[model samples]
Target: MESLIAALTLVVVGYIAGSVKIINEGNEGIVERLGQYRRSLKPGLNFVIPVFDTVLVETTREQVLDTDPQQAITRDNVPLTVDAVMYWKILDVQKAYYGVEDLESALTNLVVTALRGEIGQMDLRETVSGRNKINQALLHQLDEATESWGVKIMRVEVQEIAPSKTMLESLELERAAESKRKAAMSETESMVESIQRISRALQGQPNSQAVLQYLVAQKYVEANLKLSESDNSKIIFMDPKALTETIGELISTDQAELGNGNGNNL
Candidate 1:
């Protein structure tokens, strides 16, 4: 009789232990009875029918998912490597649990797809510089797509956007060429301006022709010295007299125009 009583007591204790569940804060539990849809369990102590109900607990707090680098191409056909992070949380544990087979995996694939699609619509420059726009676009797109999955996509961040090594080299070369072109243009403008100022200063002077010839000879020598200093430079020989004649012609035309204007004013 005593052995039977102790056995029954042990069975009762086991049943009570199995029925009582303590869920931690920031978490929720889903209870399914007989492998069918059942009510969810809130945080704190909960009770369930022993041996008939099974409980699955998950955190309701926010989660972070860091994706691996994904390869994508821009609208301009520039291949790029991209990666991102996502902040999310389970809003409906039941939906999150049942609406998707693998919630985390699904979210990752979705983010990657969206990333590639968004990047595909922009060029390389836009993709590199428009990170905030990309982030916002991804957030909105992911949030809408994940609504049914019972997950809230709080934020999306693009960590890196790197072009291919070949592309980077090409960009560097292009930039260097552009810089050289601009520098040449600036030098040409400066030379023209200096010539105009010198012409105005020598205008109407009695020895203007001598001054112009001397100035042209000095500039020609200076240019030759600079070209000689550069090992890679190809020195082009020109007649200094031709340059002097050109400047003389310009000065004469300007003086003529000035005299005509003065007569008109009178």
Candidate 2:
């Protein structure tokens, strides 16, 4: 009789021990009865139906995951190394537990495919400059894809976008070439504006003959200065006094013609 009573007592204690469950903060536990989901257990102490009920799933926490870098080629035929991060949380524990097998792996592959598809549609320059666009697109695509899995995508961000070494060098060279082209264009505009200003002074301003003579004298000085600085340096034999006299004579003739209304209009 004593042996029978002791066996019953041990069984009772075992039942009590197996039935009690303590879920930590930020955790959830789902109870399964005979391989079927029965009920979900929230944080804190909970009681189950001893040997009949099993803990099926016990997590609903947010998670951060870093995706491995994958190589993708852009529409411009430039290859890129890309990696990203995802912020996710379980919204429905039942669906998260049963809707997918190997949830993390599936999500990772989906992210990579979506990233490659979006990036492949763009050229190298757009892919680099449109990173935010890519981020938004990824978040949108993932949110839709993960809805059935009971996961909510909080955010998706592109962590890195590295191009091949040769591609990077080519991009640098192209940027440098563009810079030089813009600089040349700006200089040409400046030169044109200077010529326009000089033409206006000679055509429409007072003492236009004096302006013309001054411009000719300036050119004479510049030409002689360049000749003096040649690789085979030699003295330029042009007389400054004679040059000045020649300018004076030209100005006098132009002024006399203007006074008689016979000066050239330009």
lDDT of each: 0.89, 0.81
* Model 2 C-alpha lDDT per residue in residues 163-215, reported as the tens digit of each score: 98888899897997788568747754764455445644465468765665577
| Model 1 misplaced stretches (Cα beyond 4 Å) | 196-266
Best-matching candidate per lDDT: 1
- Write down the TM-score of every candidate: 0.77, 0.65
The candidate that achieves the highest TM-score relative to the unseen native structure: 1
What residue pairs clash in candidate 2, if any at all? none
Lowest summed lDDT over 10 consecutive residues: which window, candidate 2? Answer: 192-201
lDDT of 1 by residue, 1-266 (tens): 99999999999999999999999999999998999868999999999998899999999999999999999999999999999999999999999999999999999999999999999999998998999999999999999999998999999999999998898999997997788668757865776567667767777778876876677667767867876896655677777678767777866776777789889999
